[model samples]
Target chain A: MIVDSNLSFLQYCSNDELKTLCDTLTHDNKGEVRLSEQLTDNDVYLRCYPDNMKGMWQEIAAELQRFGGNTFANIFRGGVGASYESILRDVCKKMKVRIPSCSTVEEIEIALLTKYCEETIGSMDIDLLHELSVEIGIKPQSYNKQIVAAAILVALRRGGGKVLAPVIYYIGSNISRILIGRGVYLATAGVLGRAAAALAGPIGWALTAGWLAFDIASPAYRVTVPAVIQVACMRLKHNSHFLTAQCV
Target chain B: MHPADAKAILALKKIPGFNYLVRKYMEYGGESLYRGQNLANHVKVYEDNFPALYRVFKETVTALGIDEPELYVYNDPYINAYTYGETRTFIAISSGAVETLSPDELKGVLAHECGHIVCHHTFYNTLLYSLVELADSFKGIPYMLFGPLVLALQYWSRRSELSADRCATSIVGAQAYQKVLAKLASGMKSFKPNGKELLNQAYEYHDIIEGSLWGKIQQNCQVAFQSHPQLCERAYEVDRWSKSCRYRQSRIRVC
Candidate 1:
């Protein structure tokens, strides 16, 4: 099928614009069918179950008893479809509705998405994964230098490896304080070259782009210019030499 | 390789945080980021003030068989404009500048911007800015060396302005340009003076352009370290070139 627009399945759709989209992508076009954007195997059992972690864990435990499925790898290893990561705490807390202290990353994920989801999970979406990760309080921005530096100090106390880049300890603090906005943040001008080197791919793009938008050097003509100029200069020299000889 | 494809590849290798999106984009081909809702959602507010200008921009594109160019605004004071090169081009004019000039002047500025697209300048800039973001990333380099490189980029940037100026002049001929310049001379030059005397001042501007040796020196003095040639200089340059032996023979129809 021809790709009609930039948005994937929901690119053009609203939360309620389901009627407008064709059901060719659906395994069952009937209104009875639904797909969770999570990973699930038992589509039928998935439909009736609550989506919390407790419900998920109950489903997982029941499935284990039913099919002898009893390994951490067996459940968590399958797919990245479940929004289990987003509501991990909610899932565990929801499981608390049944039993207490049943909490772990793997259990929370598998319980919610693998067994608890009401419909088969749709394809994996990285954005949803990131959002889920955020929900679990795994803030990515806090992973910059100072946090690493503090970790290093703790590491040094426990006798870890030598500090590879100690200067960054002082610099990252300053960078965190100042570096704002999306453009190049001069966290550490000292390591800027290194950062720039790291950023070579993007910078190279900017250079090439800046060059093209700003510099219009025709390679075809670059090759031709010197060749043509050299020939023309040679003829001019020859004529000048002849004129000098005639004058003499 | 085509510049567009080549830059896309380069952008993938570079632009660190954007790699994930860029790679996914390559795997599943990305399409133009336009939708019909773009008009009523964004374009409607612009219609409130300049209703006629807004109508012409929206309806004329479909009527004239040209795709509607995407528009964006960024706040900057110094006067500058550019066009984006993509599946179709998009153009934007800053409000800081709009507040500075008139309707005719804005149209002339946009026509000059359109000239860049017509001349295919944006394709190169898209590549160049991508590289600039790359070069800009390399912060540890000695300023002694890197400083000159950036300055040179900027220096060349100033030269490219001259090239676009030619395109601007061509699209909006000397007649329209003369009116625009007069309006600018009155508004921009903080002075209160004679009326007919200023129109005759074009002769003085012309003299500064194609003048005696002293006049040439004065003209150079006026434009030194200036990225754009002054309005008088632009008028003079166009006037001189159009009157020259070679420009008359050009088939592109510039007067």
Candidate 2:
């Protein structure tokens, strides 16, 4: 029985029960979960988890709730880690919502949680949401936060739960490492996106005229800097969402 | 040094009249012209002026066990740095680079320039720099004549950049060096980066380069005239070297 120290509800289970629960978690309701053979030890989840995990995590969380583990059961379906309060604070900050300094952590958490759920996308910071939307391949017709958020949610459903890993990564959210570890989503994004990403644009060339404007000292950088910068953009684009499969 | 870079240097050596061209370029005071031009145009950094940047440059040079070269900052909005001169080598950074890079990233840039110096690349690099200027200025007849030489120099120059990146990575640690690379790729406004993400991207790029014939042709044609390797390839090379026995063994002894 491999117990994850992070999930506190494991403490409620007796030794025998823990063994059974562990078996249940690993096996799902089916037989042994067939993980991708290519998955390293770091990624212990099922390979078919894009569909399976969503349904299965809910079932397990419900079972745990019946076992009197309310806290673990109420954990966000987004698979955010134990540092939910900090991540919520980050989401609030990025969304530019003010948190009262006097408010307790729990109060602030609940307030922000309500705000995150109840507020219209229009009330959210347009720039942050737009930036995040573009990053995850959501192209809503309008900049309304709700519309954009809805688009992202729809994309998440269609693409699988891991589709928003980049957005979470960008916003500094403590999304569980388990989500990031499974990289097949981007790997399967297709050759065209990969090709466009691998061959970065001439960002360096556009900056060159400004770089060489002075023209007084023909520093050897006239040879290297813009070219190096060009290469850097290539690396950056190759790594960023540009290469990821269009989840939307 | 990367095997590709070593091979490129050998190919450049094999080019006809390559040595003669470098000799003639050097004999005509090609290096001296830049010293005067830079002294007049760029701000020289010493103990007093831009002391912080000078300290980083000095420290980087010392770490690499190389002679201290004069440091200069040229006014420019684009982030860039380069090593120039022969008998008395010099390294120059753009004002934009100073404004943008963090202290450690600046160290990585300086270390890269210092690496070029340590590797005895400045003299030939100066000739290539001059040839590019000459070709740009006289695009008709002289450009036609210098085409082969320029292509070969560019080829070697790209590989040399990989070697220099390795030197910087070894000195500043791969993480900071990668940040510098990422910053150079993007601009200051979008400076945030995860090193592993960048490496993963680089790996994807390498896959394209290896797996697709069209990708190889496209990349070769794109970089044919440029004086640096594709950034993703450089990042990929640097990341791999950072994890290699050579880098590990060196660090162990240094520690």
Candidate 3:
């Protein structure tokens, strides 16, 4: 007659009833549960439960985040923090939830706690609880092979953003710089042609002469053309936007 | 002898799931000295690797109601942690465990192990360890595959996690323990976890957790393959417990 009095969930077991339940559980042949890993550490539950409850587990996340985490630095230093048992007992006490007796630590009180959270807190508790349920062993999860697949996808995609991006930026900036330099080159050539025209005294003949000599060989042309070309090159060298388009 | 009904194991072992693996992995003799030889290589190495963990160990004994004991350590990738010894209780920490948890999360880990200390869980743990080994050694193959044997061990393991979670909540705030749990849940699932999503997962899985055999089975299956509760599961439960009315009834349950 093993019966839980306060939890409100009841089951009456006769010898045969007990035998059937025991046999079914022991030899269920359920490959779902792993053989090696121990299940002793899973005894967690909602503080107290009600048959029907209101709010879904909305604040669960906030609760987890409340205490936050310590830096790696802190743990190595062996600074202060309370023990797990004390934490469990204290939390239940503070929340005004019933603390289980020593007898209960080895019982199904854990499930009751989880149920309470789900029924009362609803999706939030479930969502929050999901974070606690490990993928292996007994929780209901259809082990997606794709997590590995996704990880593979992510791994394959690594460094693409950084590596390919810069190459494109360099090329595009140069291209844009060169495109913009066309106007400057043409204007300078015209100016040289006009000046040559004045020096040679004939408009058409002087223009041809300037085109052949000053515009082609003069220091201004040498300096300006190369500088203009370099401005395009500099834009190519420094401009992030042009670099961005190429990478994509 | 009833596989599920180990009076000694239930009374003695501190962390819940200890019996199952200790029983299963009983290739070595059941001598405390067997673990003793492993101790120098085991516990001390972790102490050197994680200096802060050693400090936590010292502080736990100094804590009220605690009597110090010798420490032990083992090498395993699983996330199991515990405390044991007769009069001098010291905590055993694993390298895999050290690598997996954050410092605060690690603090929760240590504190939970400490819970076994003051509660006299180590003595029970020693007792249960023998009981489980006896059942397995005497009963042989059928019992090994039997569900009752599996269930008891599973139940114990899950309970141990809760005890530890309580330990953490007591030392820090329940919030910190929850945060650590949430992280464990997330880490087990997708290796990469956004903090909020992990919290959300902890809440989502809250429904199936139960204290009964079926619930234990579900919980067991949930954690059988895992070394610890899913981070979200740990976090969410911590949150629920911290804010829980049942939890509040216990004095100093939260920091």
Candidate 4:
């Protein structure tokens, strides 16, 4: 498989578009499959490839035209049948979901698709989401999963490169504090904490401000952490659409 | 060795003429020149002279089961320590470090430097030192010629410190190692730094760098020439490792 240098193009694509692209690439024509020369796992490619790639080419072309020339180069460069299971697994891993052992590919796909809606999203309280919405400068009209996901999507997209870092940082700090519990907090009670406390009311604000203050080292975590959060938010948005459609 | 350190070293070795460049530097009075400068400028610690400091060095070497390297103390206000020279290596601690760190923390520092010796890190580390000096001196041809090489070395150098930190933890326990790191983080400026808080600060920095693409890019460019990982990063790594099964196993074996 030819790995594209510009994997960022994948970031621009939606879940449906990615599925469409995957189907087009892996579609078997007259039983002559284009096996990836690089990957040794023939069985993975065989079982995983979408069966109707020959029929999907026109649709993919139309989609690529919409994305323009840069995405055109990216799509062709990424022209190999990647396992849909693997893609789902990557997203699940980024979302920090611990899948049960010995699960089948179908099970994994179901797990990823329903993961946010069935588990964490259902469990999340409206007040927490409301607070998060307010923190990101969004005032939600109703306290629902749909509104929360929309608010997060807007904030994440609007913040983009300039304000995205602090926004993510703030969300992460609050989430961690929630997960771990504030009373159990033993790390941030010193001079730095005191100084940051002087800045504002919410500790997440202080955490974000403190994070922005320092210059740091280059670790792969720099990419992974934000990517994980972004993936979670994007998945939340996708799942909320499903919820809305189900209600309708 | 840390996985990152091993990976970086492999990548660094793949660079053309890198091995040859390191060999040439050693062959052409590079190590000797630095050794001479050390002997001339720094005060050597021994039984006859700085017996108290020498004891800590001896204890660390004994714990790690390596022959004692020369120990030197330089009159620098910066709380710093470094290990250099391959054939006859020496660990140099700044006077500020001697004053700042406690006796146990000082042992942790020594163990870290000795960790480099035990892991056969001195050879490549000496090359890193020389390249840094060369970068400072020549600045044009050498910098352009070995820019990527130096960056790779620095990358390896940062990971190498983590391995050293683990070694130090094995000898002195994780708490002492973390405290030593926190003390180092203070740079002799503050009274006493809370290790947990300092680690939280590191986590915050980690979040910031991870949070934004621009932040990561800015850091990558800035740290391309740095020989060490940031103090908070070191603290974070050691602390995280301390909770690992490997750290527990090493502690048991060392004990």
Candidate 5:
């Protein structure tokens, strides 16, 4: 059985399972198998199939998975060797999302997130829920009376802040400006949040507030805020011992 | 070299001052001028930087029994691949073409450019480039006097592309070759196209060309000065040749 190490398969497989599969592949091929590096989320996974053994891929996957676990179940997630389009379709179906016909990968992701939110928002805290709704740039309380509102925020984040703003603006016409403004606001908040966490003191909070005020005052300053905050946070982190010693 | 190249050469020979112009350009610093510009603008393809693509190029040259031409990749958004220089022929593929095409499709493009080298299009192409440079310098004198020469050269240039298309088809099958044309026609963004549908459209274009005199005239006028044939026409030619006995006999199993 030929062992394939596609993304969906690698995502589920434990390190031990991956090692075993790699060992089996190497042994079967007498060390011809090449494992370049561990697959990362950002990496585009190209399907690997053994040469001249085309039709027997299913049997190979089954046999390999038997040695491993449901790590191989992902190979059968759509079928023996599913196309990315099919996998996206399957995910959409399970989420009960109706994506526009022939939507790109980014659009499908947003749709799935929107559906998930609609199905499960009743249990969320009111203030946290309000923050989430603002983060996604939608009046979750008014527009989406169903479960759709919950998923939108997470979906927007996943789809990318820049991309989701236009999408949200398009969907919620009356609140378009608010949605775009909120997207920018949320993105800045998230960046500042990171800077604050990294700096870790009253001084960090003061610096974050200063940076936020400066960012709000000038659009040009907003571009540099993230970089400036990152550098400032790094410098503070590096000088933590010196500051602590001075205080003592 | 392919059979169609011989026909193109015959057509080129019939054009007045074609050989004289080519010889004159060769005598001038035409080769150095282009080589110097290319050296400045492009990065040479080598095993270290582009191992897999270099392997494909080397294998293709060996299979075709042509001297290995220097290959370079230039950063340009325009999806184009072309060959230049007379004594030292070089093939240059745009970064856009490399990024946009699949490995097999890229190989087909490289093979097509190499085909120009194999079929001796580089010499005439160099001559044409020299004439254009001269026209730029003199500002209308050369163009006015050698207008017909330019037209004839352009005509042969289009025919040369068809010959190169056949050469590419022989190396990487017709499907891959047709995809190069299809991708060039349709930019690398937006909807993915059906290959069979693209091929059928090319065939359908042939009917359009045959059915109306105006369509034929319009198509001819449109590509009158262009170096390459329209994508659909090239696609149709490649598809037709793939099924031909000549292609079957000459086909190399690279994949």
Candidate 6:
């Protein structure tokens, strides 16, 4: 059985195009039926000459061109049957599914499915499960469990992992803020160093040097020292005012 | 440090995975690669090459009490200046900026870039710039995944500008700092900006941004992807600081 796990190319392909390709690949020709596992678990193979492999690739590329145009089919024009081999490798890594180098496409698919299903089920949020159940028109009280189970099975079969949209958004937004925040602290340190140097001469210089050293050496000090200095300087000013009043 | 920067830092520390992100950024070799590319494209400015600019740069660094960084001048048409590099920091100024700005204004620009070094924004800025470039290529990857990271970086980048503006104002006077920003906005083609008018424009801009929600939103959107605030906002910040006791006290008599 020669299975092409070039299914990843279908991500860029439309559903109607995928159906046509699947139908053409699976269609019986002279008792040689090449079935897609996505459509069926039926074990079948195309009986053809080794030299005919190139012809088969040309056929597939021609079929792909109907949907994806020349650029899409151009990727496989080099007679590389495994057009999605790199994408498969990435998916395997992401899903933590291990398949031996010599393993069949069926073996890779099964391993990927098993791992993906396990992860999706294990990490499925209760709210999401409930939402999925409701969205599928299942009664939340009676058919909730069945709906969730069916959805998980479908998701596994469809090769869809848990959507990490929220997590991605949070990280993206916060990372920008964090970087900005870091810049702010750094700027604050510079301001403090300048202000201290101006106000107290040698003592101020000593304080500024200490702050800079700490800021350079430790990220924590960089964050803390600015606020501390701001408050301390304000207090010191207040105290000086009090001292001046007493002298008068 | 500016009060705003202190506030921003405090807000940033609360974010989860920030330390991890910083660690990953530090570990990335993209910055070094970028520096290598820059070294090839730009001319390194030294005492022998650009004596005046180099001297001014040195004076700013000395005044700020920071280690001297390499300076590069690139023949770009855009009137801008930036600093990059991590292990060995470098400041680059566009020829447009030098040609357009007066010596005093150029001093402010150099001082602003130096401020980034003093504030330790150099390394992170390089990392952020690299990440943004990467994000540009990988469009399928949701911005939510790395978008906020870039946004946060832009946020920091913008705030750092404010800090840098303050640094510039302290080194050169408020007038030169304001002129640099005005010149950056309206170029030196035909209009020589009056210092008082530019200052008033900054104040008017401040009022617009502060007075209405629509103005505030416009301001935010305007600076969303920019590394620096609007020239008016920056000019306003510098002008405001110039009048403050802290600015007066910290203002250095530069050579």
For each candidate in turn, the TM-score is 0.32, 0.50, 0.37, 0.51, 0.48, 0.50
DockQ of structure 5: 0.01
- Using TM-score as the measure, name the better of candidate 3 and candidate 6: 6
lDDT of 5 by residue, A1-248 (tens): 23333222333323333333323322211121212112110011112212112223334333333322233564565323333344445545543568787886545654543442333233334543454566555565454433444455455556553434333233222121222223333335466535434433332232233333333333222222222222222222223435567999
Candidate with top DockQ is 3
Q: Global lDDT of each model? A: 0.37, 0.57, 0.41, 0.59, 0.56, 0.55
Stretches of candidate 1 off by over 4 Å are: A1-248, B1-50, B55-68, B73-80, B85-88, B126-152, B181-227, B241-255
Off by over 4 Å in 5: A1-248, B1-5, B133-142, B189-192, B252-255
* Residue lDDT tens for model 4, B29-85: 877887888899999898888888888888888878888888889999877888877
- Of the two candidates 1 and 5, the one with more favorable lDDT, higher being better, is 5
Report the C-alpha displacement of residue B135, candidate 5, in angstroms: 5.3
**Candidate 4 on A1-248: residue-level lDDT in tens?**
32322232344435443343433232211111122211111223222223323333333333322222233554564644333344445545655557886765434433443333223323335665676667767778986777786666555545543234334334534223321222122223355444434432344443334333211232222222322332333334444455678999
lDDT of 1: 0.37
Candidate 5 lDDT by residue in tens digits, B1-255? 323444556667766776886877776877877778788989999999988778878888887778888898899997888888778889888888877877777878888888888777888998776677788899968889888888778777888888898888898888777777778887674435565656788778888788899999987898897778888878877776766545666774444
Candidate 1 lDDT by residue in tens digits, A1-248? 11212112222222112111111111111121213212122332233222222223323323222221123433564521123222334333433322235454333333322221111111113333233224333444444444433333343334311221121112211111111101122223335534543544432332223222212253222222222211222222333455678999
Which 10 successive residues of model 3 chain A have the least lDDT summed?
A: A1-10
- TM-score quality measure for candidate 1: 0.32
**Candidate 2 lDDT, B114-228, residue by residue in tens:** 8888767786899989888888887745558878778888888998898899888888888888888888888774568776656778878878778889998987899999998
Candidate 2 matches the true fold with a TM-score of: 0.50
TM-score value, chain A, candidate 4: 0.26
lDDT of 2: 0.57
How far is A58's C-alpha from truth in model 4 (Å)? 40
**Predicted candidate 4: interface RMSD?**
16.4
lDDT of 2 at A146: 70
- Model 4 chain A: weakest 10-residue lDDT segment is A31-40
**Worst window of 10 by summed lDDT in candidate 1 chain A:** A174-183
Q: Deviation in angstroms for B106 in model 1?
A: 1.7
- Model 3 C-alpha lDDT per residue in residues B1-255, reported as the tens digit of each score: 111223334443444665555644443444354366556577553467657766666655464345555555568776656655544456767766677776666767777777766544555354444555555688755446544544454455445555566656766566556655555554452354333465576555555554356865776576663324566655655655566544464434332
Q: What share of the true interface contacts does each candidate keep?
A: 0.00, 0.00, 0.28, 0.00, 0.00, 0.00
